[model samples]
Target: MSPLNSTFFINDDIVHPDFFFISGLAGIPHTNYYYIFLGFVYAVTVLGNTFVMFMIYSDHCLHSPKYIVVFNLALSDLCGSTAVIPQVIDTFLFKSHLISFEACLTNMYFVLGFLTMQSFTLTLLSYDRCVAICFPLRYNDLVTHKSILLIIAILWMIAGMAILIAVMFISTLSFCKSTVVNSYFCDHGPIYLMACNDNTPSAVIRWTHPVLILWLPVPFITGTYICIARALLKIAASERLKAMKTCTSHLILVSVFYFPLCFTFALASIIHRNARIINLSLSTVMPPMLNPIIYSLKTEEFTESIKKLYRRTMIHITVRKK
Candidate 1:
């Protein structure tokens, strides 16, 4: 049987129930290697994102609105990684592929919610950079801490509501078809596809949701950066360099986070479903792991703060030993 069509059968006489089986990285050979590798990735993702949050919280110099936004992104990454990876580890390593109906829907809600929040957060970061670079004098006046917090509150509220609506729609569907999910995690597409009832709602959500969450912010972010680039041309060469430096880390993050998603969506029709699912899983885990590394390496401010934190930690450790 094809991997995509693979299903678990307890016995010919037994009936399948409501629980779904997550077929993680199907058709991949040497799954033990993948299990070990994914465990390492999850560990790094947790440690990296936690370190970013710690550095931002402990250091006052990194308390600017820009870094505050980064802190939020790190938190989202940490949450997203936590929500998806452990269950995936259980599914793949422990062979606990079966997940209850309610648990699957709950996982889908949080994973999708965090994914949407990350996209919106990136857009906010882009806007923040645009304001800092384009309207240097007005940045402090325009994007104050209060305003940023308000925006963040609104973003979270919107994300939560949107995902909740999607989940409610999914809950209404009767999943009478096979409960085998052709993915490593509980994603909307695979889960909804398994429903035997009319999939019009899922199809509608699949089509329209991306427009609102993904395409909408993309053009805005692109236009904002274009404006930033134009503004850079009008400034002094030194000022231009500094402005670009401020944006470099965010630019890298945007590329890393969005490119895979775009590629996955674009090539979804051509690629095998198993491959697509694997790609989606990698995209989900990779950004969380890479975000902190990009920020630590590219942003001089964060790098310096991290170095100071390291030295202080080492000193404390030595003092304790003595």
Candidate 2:
């Protein structure tokens, strides 16, 4: 049998449900311009996050809790972006949905896993900030390096297991070609649609997991930040200003990273539709591209760091010229 029409290896008894979005997308003309646009996005995500990572590692001035959290977030952004961009670029360049069943599950596993890690890490950072600003006396005890490392370990472990559960369930699914995916990536939504058997369990995990992954943490993180802000407003003026300024960049970063993600994941089931896949892809990639810029450029310290680096480079060039 041709791969597209072949029977499932697991069970030849069932047929995969036809995903309407993939069906519709298969009819549209393939275009290279979109690939070019996505390439730019991938470049930004990689370079921007890498720059932040470099800044944190090289600058002794940034060796603090806030910058550490920022560094961790940059790491997460880099991992998450890298996990998806390779396959995404391949899809756009080749215009082929011929990803093997194993490859699809692996891609889904990492993409989902890194994204979950990002969300929880952001939440942890928010809590760290809240404790630092609102309970300075206890902040040192609460957000020590040991504590941060331990939490990071937990985040990775939880994300891995959560995604493993989902991917294991998906790996068992049988997709008989009909492999046209609507989005530029092999997201679980589109992959589920290509399956030849009943994908109801996969669908449930795919659609429901995002709630715990993305939404559940938002209110807790942002809410604590808001509470801390309110508490700051009532403190001594100098200390209050210092605390607020310290956390300002963090708060903004939290908002930018989580808000769009919450909105997008809330519409997970809807995203599998042809009418929504383009927008969903835009939403998914745009955050990774924008996250480093929003955090680094908007923060006073990061900008100053950049200016200092630039000035040092200029001085070095002048010395060479002499």
Candidate 3:
């Protein structure tokens, strides 16, 4: 048996396996500690993202085009985390690894779909920053609440359709050879590679999905910043510093979100399964937890809104005491 193939999945003959078994962190000692850690990560992700959404919703000052993208990113983070973490806990910790065919497709859709939206949203943010830095006079006209919302909606549909097609393609595959999915979840690569037949289309998607989600966005963001840099050089030192300051949080976000996945993909074949799983999970959940914190701390507008909300809460409590 090849090192890559799971022993339990090696000799199966069901043309369309009704369910697939999730295999990850099984042979490792103290694996429960890992799942427990995931629980804590999920909690922080939920609270942090929810509060960011709340801040955007309640503050009229935040009702601008930029905040609309911020809200969309927060929503994508929350939904993406919810879709992934609970399933990971249920499958690995609870020993309920049997995922039905329909459920598996559903899982693939939400996990990959929202992840796609996350990349697209970040690209949209880059566009926002590009315009603001390059064309300050036309910022209000080029970027509007309505226009931003429309772009976000369009991106959501594009992501959904792309993932939906991938899911449908998976449905056509004949998993006659393996039912053991050797990953933390029903990850596309592990599942598709196990198929008995020619999974040519799935293989295409396997590469293209990453290109669409990571490669395309990273280069675009890098180019966006290059343009921003050019624009900044044309300005005075003080104004340039202030404009660059607005990009600090986003740069951190792009780093945390993409770098791990890039590292994993680069070393996937050489690394242990457990190591890849941990890397992928972090690349998935860490951004959702850190994004809101980064924004609230680094973005001046969000910081001011947090102060206003805190003051309002204190005043409400005082009035109630009286």
Every model's TM-score: 0.91, 0.83, 0.94
Compose the digit string of candidate 3's lDDT tens values, residues 178-286.
6777787778988889877778999999998999888899899999999999999999999999999999988888888888988998899999888898889889989
Runs of candidate 1 with Cα error greater than 4 angstroms are 1-17, 314-322
How well does model 3 score by local distance difference test?
A: 0.88
Candidate 3 stretches with Cα past 4 Å from truth are 1-14
Decide which is better by lDDT, 2 or 3: 3
Tens-digit lDDT string for candidate 2 (1-322): 2334533344555333232122323444554676688888899999999999898788788777767777888888888888876666665465444666556667778888877877887788778878887888888787887778777888789888988888877666766566555555567776776676778888898766677666678778768977897988889999888777767776776666666666665675565465465555665567777878887767788888888899999999999999
Better of 1 and 2 by TM-score: 1
Better of 2 and 3 by TM-score: 3
Per-residue lDDT tens digits for candidate 1, residues 1-322, read: 3323334333343323457788857567777787777789889989999989989999999888888899999999999988988888888788787787679889999998999888889999999999988888899998988999999999999999988888887776665447777788877887777766677888788776677566888898899999999999998999899888989998999988888988998899999887887788888889999999999999999989989988998999999999
Candidate 1: global Cα-lDDT? Answer: 0.84
Candidate 2 similarity to native, TM-score? 0.83
Leading candidate by lDDT: 3
Q: Write down the lDDT of every candidate, Cα atoms only.
A: 0.84, 0.72, 0.88
At residue 226, candidate 3 shows an lDDT of: 94
Clashes of 1: 0
Error of 1 at 81 (Å): 0.7
